[model samples]
Target: MDALSRAGPRARRAAAAPGPGPSPLPWGRFAAWIDCVCVVTFDLELGQAMELVYPHDFRLTEKEKTSICYLSFPDSYSGGLGDTQFSFRLRQSGGPRTSPFQDDGRYNREAPLTLQREAAHYFGYVYFRQVKDSSMRRGYFQKSLVLVSRLPYVNLFQSLLQLIAPEYFDKLEPCLEAVCNEIDQWPPPVPGQTLNLPVMGVVIQVRIPSRVDKPGSSPVKQFNQENLLPAPLVLPSVHELDLFRCFQPVLIHIQMLWELMLLGEPMVVMAPSPTVSSEMVLALTSVLAPLRYCCDFRPYFTIHDSEFKEYTTRTQAPPNIVVGVTNPFFIKTLQHWPHILRVGELRMSGDLPKQVKVKKLAKLKTLDTKPGIYTSYKTFLHKDKSLIKRLLKGIQRKRPSEVQSALLRRHLLELTQSFIIPLEHYIASLMPLQRAITPWKNPPQIRPFCQEDFMKTLEHAGPQLTCVLKGDWLGLYRRFFKSPNFDGWFRQRHREMTHKLEALHLEAICEADIVAWMKDKSEVEIVDLVLKLREKLVRARCQHVPVREETLQRVGLYIDTIIGSLPEDLQAVLHHP
Candidate 1:
């Protein structure tokens, strides 16, 4: 019976359902004939399947043939039924077949039948025979089917014929054999080898499809064919497709390896010789390009023996993985052992504050003198030192190359010359005056700076005052100063402090109260006060100021006025130089 008719009650139920269902025949019959039938279905396109099975040697007997079939018979029946067995085959039946016998088969002594519907129009057959004398009455069926459809095969063949003459197959055979031989000759990866290098030749094979159809003519015709005359039908073998498939896993593995390289771990690549091909270098660069902007220390690639030694000896270095490529051409050109490595360097110079002081500034009248000036200098010095220390520590932790170390050192030196040295000099200039100034606890009976006390005070300030002369008045100096502009920076600071000192000195000299006190004093006392005033002016002048001659003359005239009012003898004595 045909598959749909044999489906019986199950087929009617399936047909009544709303959507497509499993073929009723296959589902029901699978259980009855499960022991004997092994049905294999090929999901491949019909033309491809036929090409694989029939190839060029075998030709179809007829163009109208639509199906290929297979059949098998059971050797024995179960339950001592005396060798009664069932058989079945698939054929191109035009319409459904049915039996006139009753469903139970008791009246006609007929065999049991089952059908499995496959693709839309195909069906698999199973037949069963009852064991006449056995206690178990169920029949056994054995069947095998190989069905090849005609539509797709005919279409594919017709297209092929239009594209090229049949003689193409004869010319293609040797090329196919050559490709298969090449694939067979490729060495399998070494067992347990940590680095499996890619074979460039195999990689080249995958490019065949793209290169197949060139501009003027096809690539197939270019292949060496010495004895046979060239013809358009003589195409290159399809075995190249197989070779491409064989290399697919290697390509995938290489891609994965590229991802791992992005982790920025240290890597060592072993080459069979001292130098690598330009192609290999290009490949390596492409793999590493993703990490070009990374801020961390870059992975190293080098061919130098010393570098390899350094990498091995440095315990603090990142773990190194060995990389190798399978191409013997590359291998022979690369270094043998302790291979070349490439190391990456930091690309970003970290952002640093333009001003050294990170902290907020306190309000102050002037940085020209006293504690305000001294404190500002000290604060900036400490901030710069801290910044330098932090940067150095980061460099050490990152383990930068020697070139990077030198660059950082140069930067630090520039910072010192620009900001630190001038600050130190300014602080030194202010220290003595800062220490000498003291507040009085009680009013003194006599002026604090008479000639006697004045010389003593001057003696106390002498050593520190000398320091001003010894230091660079033009500004702080360096042996090999790169910044001539630093001289201007220093001079501007000194000029501000000198101006403050000049103002203070002039104010004391012009004080009305100081003149009144001089008038009341004895000639000797007046002379002594004048000397003290002169000493204060000298101190101010020493601080890089050009003390005004007019101011000095004015102070002398006031002392002369006091002397003019004194007795001639006293005046003469006071005028004694």
Candidate 2:
């Protein structure tokens, strides 16, 4: 038979995981095909074998090595006694066996066989089938085909290992074997059993000595000390970050890892989450820890943060491992944080790293803005200062003194004074970070978040004035058009859009600076400047969104022209100057 005919389908051992055999290869396959047993084998390459799962620490002892498998042979290898040019040989249980191809031409040729084995404490069992050739040919009687037991896909590696002699396997076909002196069982269950629990674990770093929170546990290195800076510190490896960027959202995969590694067995992880550099701690400790197996222990962070949470709920992960980060200190210093070192057992490193801390920046000065805020054209979006103050005061009334620390009191005061405080202020530190992204009535006072709302709220902002110039937009226009993530099968356009918007914001800030400089000037100068700026604003906004710059510019110029076409600013009865 040619090489193509020699290849066979994978074999799931009927002896170990016994189930009704697959119905005879549908109607297309004929009786003649079952006469020749061609055992197609896939031997596991050294590295590839690591992927096959086994109990933890299964290879600790040499005598404990019982069964090993490399190929999944189809059931067609049971018969076909033939006198071909070569003999059939294979490495099986106990030892190797070599025999000539049989030419019996009868007696059921194929034996839908699998190259799998079992073990107890010590002994191993393997099955090697070699049919003796009955053909009257003289020398052809001793030829054989050897089967290597392992997974398929070894074509490349096997070529490199050609120098290594191939072994012929033989089946033990043992009797009721019993363990004696930790070495007797010939055929029994493997060393480990499947687990049925949660798989949340920690990769200990800086192993918090048992002495922590005690007299002299030892202090972790802090950056505050001037003279102690060490050699160039590498960026905290974001190895786990890839998990958050996978197809499965990071959180779901994390919970799944808990289920697979810590839960029941005879199962496998088919889909993992996409990975993200920012979510490293969450990926390893919480996401992939449960997927670890003693037989095949490979740790990978494939889950993406964007999709991870779609699969999890309250009970999916441990309640203690909050998915969100609410710590104000952590939020303020997000960029400076190093690799997230798992602080506790729960995968809650989304907050801050172990050594890093958020230091509150002292307020330089608070600008009093009662009159400007109340009278601003965009006054509608601004909350009533009195109402905000009253609400915060009410919250403060019942809280413990500690909860209302000086910092908290100051922040609450800012809220009361009609200032939009960041939503992070309201959240508890232990809570997840996702809450900040959620929509709420009070609304988060985050920077670009507020700006996003302000732009959309035309009526509330009351004739919002904008000053933009083509020159103000340098890299922004180039970036938006250069982005390839939009049309070519985009998986995450939302994030891209956000990035584009942020680029545009810098343009707004530059425009604001130019307009701020001309706030006070000659009427005619201001009017022309306003017209030009309005033209730019309209153009910029229309370029990105649906609105047109021509239309808004025309409207702004018409309004300003009409107003400029009016008398002077009738000051409060010309306050005696």
How do the predictions measure up, each by TM-score?
Answer: 0.18, 0.15
Error of 2 at 107 (Å): 64
- Predicted structure 2: lDDT: 0.24
**Cα RMSD for candidates in order:** 43.8, 31.3
For model 2, the run of ten residues with the poorest summed lDDT: 176-185
lDDT of 2 by residue, 1-577 (tens): 8544453321211122222332233211111111111222232232112122111212222211211222111112224443211111112333332222122221111110111121111111112223453552321222222212121111211221121112222311111010010111011111111111100111111111121122212234223233323322211111112222221222212222232222211111111110121122223322322111122111111122222233233334221121222122222322222111112112224431112121222321123211000100111122234433433453346543333232222332332222111212221222223334321112133333333343234333312222111121212212312322112212222333443343343233333434344456566664554445454455445444333455445545444444444346622222121
Q: After superposition, how far is residue 335 of candidate 2 from its true place, in Å?
A: 45
Q: Which stretches of candidate 1 lie over 4 Å from their true place?
A: 1-414, 417-503, 519-522, 534-544
How many steric clashes between backbone atoms does each model show?
17, 85
lDDT of 2 at 247: 16
Assess each prediction's global lDDT (C-alpha) against the native: 0.30, 0.24
Cα displacement (Å) at residue 548, model 2: 78
Q: Can you give the lDDT of residue 571 in candidate 2?
A: 23
Q: For residues 94-152, what per-residue lDDT tens digits would candidate 1 score against the true structure?
A: 44432211123211111100111111222222121222423322332222222122111
